[model samples]
Structures are given as structure tokens and as C-alpha cells.
Target: MSTAPLVAVPAAAAAVPRHVAIIMDGNGRWAKQRHLPRFAGHKAGVDAVRRVTRAARALGIEALTLYAFSSENWRRPEEEVADLMGLLRIFIRGDIDELVRENVRLRVIGDHSRLAPDLVAMVDAAVARTAANTGPILAIALNYGAQAELAAAARRLAERLAPHEIDEAAIEAELDTRDLPPLDLLIRTSGEHRLSNFLLWQAAYAELLFVDTLWPDFDAEALGAAVAAFGRRQRRYGGL
Candidate 1:
């Protein structure tokens, strides 16, 4: 699906949001509609990732979180899931050097125990390699679910603190995104209208946008237009 080509922010638009999150949706649907294998869409989705990552950085977004793989995604057909994993491996192998060149810090949030050992190790290696970069962050949400993240954070609090000692701050400190900036704007493509359990905690105050553009079709224009729209919103954080 095509989107607005104009990304030029008007004077009325506010400063760019610092932290942006995206639910990259519609890969399977994009493939199905094109009469191609779903993995074809996923492969193209990789290109979209490259485009969006560069756009986010250029837009001065301090942090960019992408919903790469979800915990629920494992329920898909086993062969498809395997294909997704294979894609991740190839993407990392092919793209990590570019990430380094871009000065983007790589991070992953979610349960690592369920992933393949080699995959986890590879991801860790990539993160470690990019640990020194000071540019905009690129957090990949792999096998991540927000509700599960909340529960795990709570579990960590329980392990170290008495019930009375555990407070909001304690729980917040244990979240995977504890050190990241507050979520500013969240975008979901493919015309999806729900969060699908991605970043439930961090999105508490995020400005939300849903676009009809499929993930594979998303590009700088789509993302810049979303960011510009976010700038026009007057965020009061519940204040009058």
C-alpha cells in the first residue's frame, strides 16, 4: 500500500519525538495477496527495516524499537517459523556490519531462553559488537511480549524485595527498557489497530499511529510522515 510521500514538517509541528516504536505488520498478508510465499514478504520486510532504521536515525529519533518477532509468532506453522529464524540469521549476518557503520547500537529485549542457542549467541555477538556506538539505538524486540515482560519484571522484584519493599519504581527498574528513554510515539503498519502485546508497559504514554502501508512497503516517506504527524500532536500526558 502506498502512503503519503510528503515528510516535510510544517512550522507548526513540534520537535521530533525521541523514542519511536514500530509494530512491523503485514508480511504474511503482503505475501498472500501477491501469491508468493510468506518468506518472500519477510525477506522484503528486511529491506524495509534497513530503510526505516536509517530514516529514524536521520530524523533524530534517539531510540527506535521494532517488533521483529513476537512470542505468539511461534504458534505459526513450524516451517514458517523456521523460515523466519533463518531470515533473522541471514539478516544479522548481512546487516550487522551496516549497523556498525551507521553507529547504531543494537539491543534485544525479550526472553532469550526459548530461542535457538546459536541464534541467541549470534544476536549477543552483534549487540556486543555495537555496544560502543553512541548513535541512535536500534532495539529489536525478538520473542517479546509486553505482558510477559511485566510478569518477568515483577518476578525479579519478588526475588529480591519483600512485598512492602517492592514499589512502582522497583518494578520499572527491572523492565528490559528501563534505561531507554520514555516511549514517544508508536507506529503500527498494515492498517492494524491494536497493540498485539508489543511494548504494553513502555507504551503507557506513547502517541499512537496506524498506517495502511504494509511492513514490506514501508519506507522513509511513510516513517517521516508518521513522525511529522506525531510532532503535530499536543501531548499533555493527561494534563489539561
Candidate 2:
């Protein structure tokens, strides 16, 4: 992390957010409203991912974390699950060059043990190939569930603690997001008004933004509007 200042400035002049997290919601609903298969909406959502990543990079945002798949999603119909995984494979195979060209670093955060070996390999390749990129870091949360993450963090802490090393800081340090900055802003689209267990620990102080646009339709303009709204708020961090 940089030692740069967090000086407050006019909303228009404020430095772009260092970290932004998004819950890509409403894909199935979007497709339903259009009388299309849910997978179609998911596919459309992928295009939105490309657009928002470019916009975030252009705006100089340092990190963008997207909730691509949650652990709960595994309970859905097997066909839908298969479709989503297929899309992920296609993305990894076809999008590597574009990602490298854009200087974007791709990362996957979540348990991948249950995923097919081929998909796992693809994700690893994407992360390794873009590891050196200097542009915005894009983290895709796949099979990620915040409660699961917290449990995993606790298990790690318990394994290391000999009853003397237990502390709040120690537990926090064991979290997966220890290296990432605390979330500055969290956005959820499709008019949903809940966190859905995304970034439960890391979003402790993040400003929440909700938009009516579905994931497939979310674009740069929507993002800009969200940022503008965030700029107007007073971030007290529990201080008066």
C-alpha cells in the first residue's frame, strides 16, 4: 500500500476510489423480464464486466472486486450452474489477451476446490499471466460466501493461536482481504438493498449504493452516478 495522504477535496476533484466492490445482481430477473433464458442475462452481464473494468481503469481506480458467483449459487439447477461455469471457461480462454493488453491484473478470490480441474487451471493461468500488470486490479469472487470466508479465517486463526496470540487484530490479519484495503464503497445493482454476505468483514465501513439497473445493463454512466453520490456523503467512520 502507498503512504499517500487521504486528504479531502471537492467531490469533483477528489481522487478516484482506491477500492470499489460490486454485487452484480438481477441478471436472472433481467432475462426473465425479456422472456429470455437466465443464462442469456448472465452472458450479457459479462459484457457489462468488460465495460465497467475499462471505466474503472480509465478513472484510475486501483482495485475493483466483483461478486461473480457466490457459494449459495451452487444450489441452483445443475444446468444453470453448468452454464455459468462454461461462461467462466470461455471468458478465461478468450479474454486473456484483452486483459493483458489493457494492463489489468486479474485475480480470483474464493475456494476453488469444487470447481472442475479445467476451470481451475484457466483461472490460475489468468491470474499468473496478468500478475505483473500495473493497471487496475480486478478481483472476481467465485464460489465466495462471506460467512464461509469468515469461518475459514477463524479456522486459520485457531490453528495458529496457542491461546496467547488471540486478538482482534490477529483474526483480522488472517482474513483473505488482509492485503486489500478496506472497501471504500460497495454497490449493488438491480435495486437489491442487502449485502448478500459479500465482503462481510471488509465492508465494515463502506458506503453502500443501490441502483435499479440490472447487472447486464449497468454501464459507465451508472458507475459515474454512483461515484457522484458517494462524493456527496460525509464519511464519519463512527466519529462525530
Candidate 3:
């Protein structure tokens, strides 16, 4: 019962980003342009998530991180936030089987303390189900903010490690992306040029790409183009 698309490009064929993060933006704008409700654009954006995920795996990306819901998004209208959460639920329910079949693992970053009890449970269960899969990783950031993550890491490490043992290494180990590969390429759709507090620490050396295409219209071709751009960049990491 899987409907995943086929990918013909092998990972070895190009310099694909091993760890790619995308800020899925412009859902509301995409809807507004079409004279439809914002929820429709979000629903279409979910389809883009599916397509990009498949493309990421096919291109041999080790991990794909998506900016799903941010902490600041809670300030939106109550009905809109609820609809977005509902779409997330539908996405997981519809795509879990396809992900499992493709041997891809699912992970959700960010704190779940404020989420509904049942929704948190569902996320936990999905992560558990995909934990043992030995394939590409799909990370979704829900209610995540880089500043909050850094603050939490600092607090946790301060309590766990003595001041003498605390350093950049200790803090990095406690970050949300500690286990994932260093971010290589960061992308934002809808012509956005800012990070918007997504992954400040991890993106220290990442190549950023901003595209005019809306999230709902982003497909494998757009993703591949971004990767190509990343491949052309020279990352010095402050070295000669």
C-alpha cells in the first residue's frame, strides 16, 4: 500500500548535501494567490514534504530536517493553528507506511511539553516505530526555536557537567542536532533570505539557498537545483 515515487539519480553521481534542512514557507501566500483558504496551501505543502523526502533519500542525503512548526507560530489564530496540527496528524497517518517501506526513519525535534497529550504520544510512537530503520533520517521540527534549544542545552549541561568540564564540545553535544551530521545546506522557499531562528549554531558553516518557489510548488527539481548550488559553493570554515 505504498505510493512513493521512484528516483533514478544515484547519490554518488553528484555532491549532494548529506544533511539538508528546509524552511517550508509561503503556504499562506500560495493559498492567498489562489483565492483559497490557507489550510489548502498547508495541505498542498504536505504533499511537497512527501516529494522532497523521497528525493532526499534517493539522492543519498543522510538526514533531512524540515521546519514544520515553530514556537512563534502559536501566536496565530486558534483555528489556524489547530488546522495545521490536524494536517500534521493526517500526514503522519498517511505516510508512516510509505516511510517504513522505504526504510526511512522519522524523528521530531523541539519540545513537546505544550502539545496535546495524545498528539505527543503519537509523535513518540512514530519515532519509536522508525528507530531501528537503517536508512535516511527525516527530522521535523515542531515548536522549535534555536535560541530556546541553546538555552535548554546550556541549562541541562550546566546541571550535568561541572564548570571545568563545560566548553564548546559539551554544549554542542547537548544540542538538538547533536547526533545528526553537521548541516551542509539550508534552504528557504518563498524567496525568504533569513534564517528565522531555525538552526543558528548548526548553520555556522552551512550554505544557504533561497528560492522564490512556494513550499506547495517545491518539488524534486527545485530540491536538486538547490543541491547543485550548494555543490558549487566553497566552504572554508574560516580556514585558508
Candidate 4:
């Protein structure tokens, strides 16, 4: 049986969701179905990113988080990994100016120590360039793993507490997503039905929406449907 809730909210409500998170899945499968290389699907997925970002901004969404690259992706073929990094660099260099023009602020999360120095530099430059934008914030999770993030947060909290300082608030303060709002709607593309360690802590009570469309094929209409579905949800937040 489906575990999804059936709550309803009016369309005119001013309290629309402030954050939307997505797990872009099915890139490799999309490529395989076409007898093309996996990187082609990834390239196409980048185009979807642009479309979704534009759609989110138009919908008055305050923040959008995209699960781009996870720590587990490092286990993939070396050449594919290099190509993904290259694609990221290309996107940063090619899209920053346009993103700034659109008033979008680009923020990245996850461990960057393993990234190539040049790529890291480009990401940093892009973030700095778009820092002053007043529009919707775009957060890309690269080399990110929710489990690792939580473990890291726990370690930091443990370091700060001898014994007396241990508390939920303290642990929350140490989390990497502390500065970000809790997830409002979490969407996963490619028909996947699992969290896959995307945002385990932050998505505790988020509405989950799944679509069978591949990441590369995701567009504005699909995004609109997700928002509309969210509008019909009655978010009790653990209350009646």
C-alpha cells in the first residue's frame, strides 16, 4: 500500500513551500536505452537543471536543492567521473553569467577536498559572483552523501561536547544543512522509490514525489505538476 498522505491546501495560501529538493536519477539508464554513452545522459541532465531552476524561480520558490553528485558516484568508472567533473566546470563557466543575470544565487554543498583544485576554484568563483543575487537560491549537492554529512555533524557535535553539552539542539547546530530550511517537497526522477542517502536528516517530514521521467527529459511541465501536487497536500507537520 502507498504510504503517501492525502492532505489539501488552498492555492491562494501565502505559506507556499519555501524549499524544494530533487534527486536527479536515471541518467545512465536513459543513455543505455539509446545505446549512447552515459555521459550523454549527464549532458542532457544539465539542460534539465537549467529548465527546472528557471521554473522554480518563476514559482516564487525561495530555495531549490539538486542532488547532482553523491559520494558513492566516485565508485563509477574513472573516465566517466572525469567527464562529470569536466561537465560541472563547463556548466559553472558557461552558466554563471546567465544565472547572475537571472538573479539566482548558486550555493554548493558536500566535501570538496577530493575535487580537482581548478574545478573547486571555478565553483568558488561562481558562488562569489552570484552571492549578491536576490532571487531564488540554487543549492547543488556535489560529492555529497547524507550519511557522511550526518556522521560529520555528529563528530563535530561530539568534539564540542565533553558530556554536558550533548543535546539535540547542539547536534542540529553542527549539521551542514543548519543554515538551510527543512525540505518542503522532495522529488525524485526516473521512478526511483528510495531516498538513496540523499537528505536523510533534512527530509524527515518532507513530501515525497516520484516521476518516471528520466532526468534529461524533466522539464517545466513536470515541475509544475510537482508544485501543484504539493499545493493539494495538507502538511500537518506531525499535528492534527
Candidate 5:
């Protein structure tokens, strides 16, 4: 049985989602398909990130959250992990100035306590330098897990209030994404149909769009198509 919801929003009246999140997948698969090194695919994925970020900014998206690295990714081989970190460092150092110039606010959301000090410093520098930018927010999730996020939020909520005082609103406020707009749409590439623990609490009512295009191959056209599909669906928030 399909668990998908019926589309209620008319195509003509559909508006671009205010907040969009993406689970970038299939870098390694893309590399294997091309008979190239996995890092090659990851490098290409960085280009895709640049393209999508610029496109999203041009399209006036309020907020864009990208699932960069998950807590589970640490289980990967040390060599691959090192390559990923190197790419991240390169991306941060090479692009922070440009991001600032374009007025894009950089924000990293996830547990950074276990990260290397240098990596943490770079991430902090990016955020700090762009702290005053009033443009679109680009939130990158690193070492993030939706279940962990919810669990942490619950822990915080429990510490701040009595059981009787806790409610839906209180829980929402305690979430890591409390300051951001509600997630409107989530897109996962590489033909993935599952959330994979990305933004579970924030995506309680978000529309999901899955594409077969690998992350490295994703381009502006891909993003446009997904957004168009989103526009065609009506979000009733469980109401008629």
C-alpha cells in the first residue's frame, strides 16, 4: 500500500515553498557508475551545491537546509571520512568570502562537540562572518540525526518545565530549528523514498519529493522541477 497523500493544491495556484530541505545522496554510487574515485563524486557534489545555492538565492527562497553529513556517516572508512573533511575545509575556506559578498547567511546545525577543533573553528568562522547578512539562510546539517535532535529537544524541555506544562508548542519551541521557518518541502535525490532521519520533527507535515538524479548530477533544472511538483500539490495541513 502506498503511504503517499493525495494532491489537493491546484497546479495554477501553487506557490514556491518558503523553506526547502534536501537530502543529498548517491555520491559514492555516482562515482562507481562513472568508474571514478568516490572523492571525485563528492567534489562534483560540491559544484552542485554551489549551483543550487545560487539558484535558491535567485529564486528568493527564505531558507534552504542541506543534509551535509549525518552522525551515521562517521561509521564510514577513515580514508573516505578524511576526504570528506578535506572537501568541507576547502569549501569553507574557498567560499566563505563569496557567501558573505552574496549576503547569504551561513548556519551549521548539528552536534559539533565531537568534531575536530579546526573544523569547528572554520564552521564557527563562517557563521560569525555572515552573522549580519540579511539575505537567504543556508543551513547545513553536519553530524545530525533527526531522532537525536528530537531526543535532545525533549531533554531540554523536560529540564525547563514540569510535565504538566509541556505541550506541542513547547516541544516545537525546544527543537533545534525553532528559529527557522517551518519546513515546507523536503527533496531527496538518488531515487530515495525514505526520510533517513532527516528533519523528522520539522517535517511533520512537509511534502516529500524524491528524484532519481544523483546528488552530483543535480542542477537548477532538477530543483525547478521539484519545486514545480510541490506547487502542484495542495497542503491542507490535515484540514479540508
Candidate 6:
């Protein structure tokens, strides 16, 4: 019930977004194309995550939010869900040192109440381990849904105040991403042009970029291209 306001970080000079979010889509499709199990693509997508993180940091992005798993993702086969959870465990354990070494702070945004106890522990550990880092914030959206986030924020606001006190800023302050910068650019891969329930509230003024590259195939070059494209557009925010 902390009423702390979210601080907004302005983008660095020369057109780089202060915050960039990516819908890491096409893991299963990438696997299908390779004649491999979907898990293989998910595993490979981890490499892409690493690459993109590095690229964003090099590009001076202050925050990078990655859509790792959505709330609807649980509807996937039980085995697939288990596999994804296993991957989460592995990534947290295997990558924390590297993230710390690179001075990256790990932040997980979602309704983690449903997550398994062990997975939650690992997530908490990762956050704690990187809590001191001052580098780029790496936000992994797991079990996250935009509608759910908004609903939760609304509920929190309602409980904490009377109707007269609730406002856009109040709701935003209750959001999971309230600690991070406002989203500036959101990229979706695998030819998807939709938000897919990722950061809907935070991306109100963000530039959307869609690419055909699969999640696993996304690399530094692809990331650079997306940023370059973003640089070419004018964001008027509903005004001329």
C-alpha cells in the first residue's frame, strides 16, 4: 500500500528509447520450422534474450522489458508449462552471475502468487542478487497479462482510497512496473503486430515495431534495425 510515485526516466539523447519492451514471439513456430520440439526453440530463445540484452545495454537503453510468459500461457500443455518453468529455473541460476557481472538489475513483473514456491524463490533470489546493480534494468514478464495488471491496479486503488482520490496516476502507481521507466518502444517479432497483453498501460505512448524474425533468430542486428526504425518516426502523442 505504498503510495510512492513512479519516476519516469527520459530517453538518452540521439533517439534511443529510455525503455524498450519486446514480445519474444515465435518460439514454437521457430521450433516447428527446424523440425525440433517447441522446448528447443524456447531454449534457443534464451540465447536471443542474452543477445538482445547486450544490444540494448550497448545502445544506452535504461530498461528492457521482455515478455517471457503470459498469464494465458498456462493453457499450454502441462508438459510445456513444466518445461518452461524448468527453463526459468535454469536461466535464473545460470544467468545471475553473468547479469551481475554486466551490471544488470533483474526485475520480474507478474502475478507470481500462482508460481511454484521454488520458482518464486529463484526469482526473489535473482532480484536480490542484482539489487545493487545500477546498470540497465532487465524486466522479465512472467505470468503477466495486461488486463490482469490493470484490474489488479484498479482493485488496489479502490481498496486504498475513496472514489474521489483515484486517478490515472494513482492506478499507474500501483502497477507492477511503477518502479521502472515509462515504456518507449515495444517490438513484437514473428510477424505479430499486436500487443499480446504485454505492457498495455505502460506502452500508451510507445512506438510499436513488428518484425518477421522469430524470437530465437532475433539478434543484435535485428535489434539495431528496430531501434533505427523507431528513430525515423515522429511521436506526436495525439498532438500535431
Name the best candidate (by TM-score): 3
Model 4 residue 174 lDDT score: 70
Angstrom error of the Cα, residue 71, model 5: value is: 0.7
lDDT of 5: 0.86
Clashing pairs in 2: none
In the range 125-230, model 1's lDDT, one tens digit per residue, is: 9999999999889999999999999998888888888999988778778998987888999999999899999988788899999999999999988887898788
Q: By lDDT, is 2 or 6 better?
A: 6
User: What total of clashing residue pairs does each candidate reach?
Assistant: 0, 0, 0, 2, 1, 0
Scored by lDDT, the top model is 3
| TM-scores of the candidates in the order shown | 0.93, 0.91, 0.95, 0.91, 0.93, 0.93
Instruction: Please give, for residues 1-240, the per-residue lDDT of candidate 3 as tens digits.
Output: 435455545344557788999999999999999999999999999999989998887678899999999999999999999999899888888888788888888988899657888788888888888999999999999999999999999899888788899988888899888889889999999998999999999998999899999999998888878887877788889998
Q: What TM-score does structure 5 among the candidates reach?
A: 0.93
lDDT assessment of candidate 3: 0.89
On lDDT, the stronger of 5 and 6 is 6
What ordering of candidates by lDDT runs from best to worst? 3, 1, 6, 5, 4, 2
User: Per-residue error at 156 for model 3, in Å?
Assistant: 1.1
Each candidate's lDDT (Cα)? Answer: 0.87, 0.83, 0.89, 0.84, 0.86, 0.87
**Runs of candidate 6 exceeding 4 Å displacement:** 1-12
Please give the range of 10 consecutive residues that has the lowest summed lDDT in model 5. Answer: 1-10
Residue pairs clashing in model 4 are 7-234, 8-234
Off by over 4 Å in 3: 1-14
* lDDT per residue (tens digit) for residues 68-106 in model 6: 889999999999999989998888888888888889999
- Model 3 clash tally, residue pairs: 0
lDDT of 3 at 141: 97
Structure candidate 5, residue pairs in collision:
9-234
In Å, residue 11's CA in model 5 sits off its true spot by 11
lDDT of 5 by residue, 51-163 (tens): 88877776667899999999999999999988999999988998888888888889888896578899999899889999999988999999999999889988998887999
